[model samples]
Target: MGSSCGPTGPEPGAAAERVIYLDNAATSWPKPPEVLAAVQHYLLEVGANPGRAGHFRAAEAGRLVFRARRAVADLLGLHNPMRVVFGANATWGLNQAIAGLLRDGDHAVTTTLEHNSVLRPLHRLQEEGRITLTVVRAAGDGYLDPDEVRRAVQPGRTALVAVTAASNVCGTIQPVAEIAARCRTLGVPLLVDAAQAAGAVDLDLARDGIDLLAFAGHKGLLGPTGTGGLVLADDFDAARLRPLTVGGTGSRSDSVRQPDFLPDVLESGTLNVAGLAGLAAGIDWLHGPGGGPEAVGRHELGLRRRFIDQATARVEGFQVAGNPAGPAVGVVSFTVEGLSPSDLGQGLAREFGVLGRQGLHCAPLAHETLGTFPVGTLRFGFGPFNTAGQVDLAVAALAEICRQERP
Candidate 1:
């Protein structure tokens, strides 16, 4: 993790065919072998609908699904596992929370650091006159002050305060505990979009006073896509939150009405059992004694520091979005002179086989906040499996591109 690791970049002539992947922000790659095995086990060995039948396969599937729920709960430091609800992804969970909870005349407070998953839905609700939305602005450094968030709450009118745990574009970790405390003081429900923070940060849902938390299984959790969930607080009243979809939950069969419980209320129809199986394995690996969020975060942060330090030193006219000194969870966005983000990204891929994400990163407001609006920045997201060598290669690739394009 230190400079003693030496230059890990590729050799001068050995760059063309080697692949350097630094796009973990979108979705993690080279998933843990345990995740793949778990998915295969679910599909091949226990190919049965969970909670639908009394047979052995169905029972195994049901047990696996329940274990996945508990694994997510444990990962987030929630004692009651029933509060975890499966969804297609964090977007699905965010929609359920935004559309289900807020009603006409209700007010909700969010920030510019949100992804479209949060912004679009809130905008729609505001446009439809369902809820009055207030977007609190973060500081120029991309850091949101808790007091500023508190001032945006409308007391009796504010039904919910939604926010992202970290910025997806520039990787600024928000002051979640401070904001959660303010929300608790106002007796307003808090919903956290944890798509970037799940396995990259240590989140204590109960201790942090978060009412609801939404996270993606594919990113930090190292699970397959189409796997994610929302965790509700123990005291959270499900009656206030409505289901986006209602159908057979494999329970409450006698009545045609939707089940009035924790998970069954939110999860309806056939669940993504295979994906959930992989998610469970991912969480298990994350929660392993030697490997946890604390360890994973430290590893990613080291790599992030290495990349940022090298890039800033080597790339001329390099501009890093957001406060480079601020807290982050392994994501960095930067721009070089005389190159569009797309062009720079493409050049890295074509010339160096370095894969990175370019453009607004699905968070235009975040770029707007960073003053990189229309053009955006090249983003390199590090994962647990990413090494110092990979980070070095990316930096060298960018440095080379910057030199070639600028001169």
Candidate 2:
């Protein structure tokens, strides 16, 4: 493949760099400078348990948490920040949403492209005889047909429909808007797992008809690990779902039962103050006056387009996966002929210092839908810090590896 973009290395006086980070989907790298600063500041300046005390430090911590909630709410175009409940990660949020919503005899629908987070919980519920689940099949590219979802919905019995906004393995963006609209028409709640599309795509809770959205803060949101949340729509009440964990919420001290409130009801133990502080800073950096998710998304999309073009043109025996026509975020996945994805991933890291992810990417169902199960595929996810030049280098490295490893 010809290199259309120039290389992006360290500055003139800077020391040598180790590797090119391309595994943003697993967890973003090179988070904004403000994110690090915010984490440090929180740890040093205001290290206190939020909502646990009335002290200045405690109040400050509480304010930081609230600010993060508002930031997430604004990003999703949600009106109430309280509806955003912080969790350990997207999986945690998904567990809370699924486990809470589904009850005995309730019927639910989900896509075959869902990550383990959604599938595992639903499977457990099925085993326990709590709810009946229907796994809707996606196309070869992992694109779920909204009509499939509509057909799966059994008006009175189907209480909720869970779907992924984008496939983590194939980078196929689903018709979430159409699915959500169908769910709304059927009066069934729609829970969206935006772990792969949150910051890389524009999502309006109201316009998109998303009743519940689970996202990872560490991925596209550019926050530290252990930061993620579930944004509940106004019509969707958190009370319908039971708390996953309960301990100290720093509220209703006198009562033995947990407080029944938006955040307080869901947030049990002490929150990840440092991570939340960084998450707040990250949200601001992404949605500030000049900076916005759309701007960052465009940059990522350019890199994806460049990679797709280069790989399609020159990389022999390589097959790109996912819906080419549908709009994708920054994620892209492909398989090299006669080469195991794990081997290609290791070669990219060891030989070329290009860090990309391999295997099922915690979404075996997605690979199963794409017909790349067990062996999986190599995934290269773009970030705000990633440049088009990096995309060129990655493609070149893959092509070279294919040539050298030709069977």
Candidate 3:
């Protein structure tokens, strides 16, 4: 599994002295060196917009962007790279898919485990009287039943079914394949938000029967922020979806009508080319020569297991939000009996240099589903860069934080 792209931990220093970044779910830090180098090269040597002009540099930039698109498509199990439409992030992609496809009188189905990225847009549409919405609730363990989703879908009435592949707050991996199977049989398109599952879970859009997928580059994909997109299945029709934004696509110069093409229709205006370059490097690093997602997933899981084992055994008042063990991703979230999440998170950051997420993590219903609303749990999103030593130090810090009384 050794490769130049493998995560390299912090340099030698006291455990408390170094910043133990545990908020990988927000955005990954200490990005792979290859990602940094690729970005620098793009900004310095190849400084031109893709598809904007016919110059040599522009053509090369376009080529670089296409390479990234291909990498993303392959990673997500798509046969055609052109189906990957770049966007600002998973939120943007979700809005495009949810808002664009659902028309008047259309009905949409979703789950409680989804982040606000999915909920907000769908709610907005519901409020506007454009679409009818059905949100299925998950169990306390954060698992959504595929049959529940099947029951929610109305044949020829449900336009789309949206669900999360993994919960950002609880790290539960939903039964997307089974859900997709039901949707396929009922003639409904399934859109999965893979923000937390892209690089951490085994997702094959074709095999899983997923119609559309939204992913974040910075979270599980280990790419730079401001990089992410929507991936369409080979058989899915891109024409059904409308553009979220439209501007200079550098195509169809004669007319102002938005070019109705695979990428040009959805991807308008200039893209973050430098960021895309870095994203390409990140994707290549994961699949080119290293052990890929399997190696990384195992590493993060080991770190999660280490933290849970140490924290629950050595510390008091440590209760995780969901089932401690399950078919899920690498995120672990817990609440302390004597301490509030904000208080504990502040103590970890100020006293021990351990940074983690607190509160509902922008997933209010997810916390409500877990019965942890109003007051949420402290979350530690394990990543490939995190080590067991760091987890040990974090556990020790948590013990100290719990020992102290409330203010």
Best by TM-score: 3
Question: Clashing residue pairs, candidate 2?
Answer: none
**TM-scores of the models, in the order given:** 0.95, 0.95, 0.96
Q: Comparing 2 and 3 by TM-score, which wins?
A: 3
For each of the candidates, the C-alpha root-mean-square deviation to the true structure, in angstroms, is: 3.4, 2.9, 2.4
List where candidate 2 sits over 4 angstroms from the true fold: 1-16
What is residue 294's positional error in candidate 2, in angstroms?
Answer: 1.6
- How many collisions between residues are there in candidate 2? 0
Summarize candidate 2's per-residue lDDT along 82-108 as a digit string, tens digits. 999999999999998998888789999
> What TM-score would you give candidate 1 relative to the actual structure?
0.95
Which residue runs of candidate 1 sit more than 4 Å off their true CA positions?
A: 1-17
The segments of candidate 3 whose C-alpha lies over 4 angstroms from its true place after superposition are 1-17, 288-290
Q: lDDT per model, in order?
A: 0.87, 0.85, 0.87
User: Residue 49 lDDT in model 1?
Assistant: 97
Candidate no. 3 TM-score: 0.96
Error of 2 at 95 (Å): 0.5
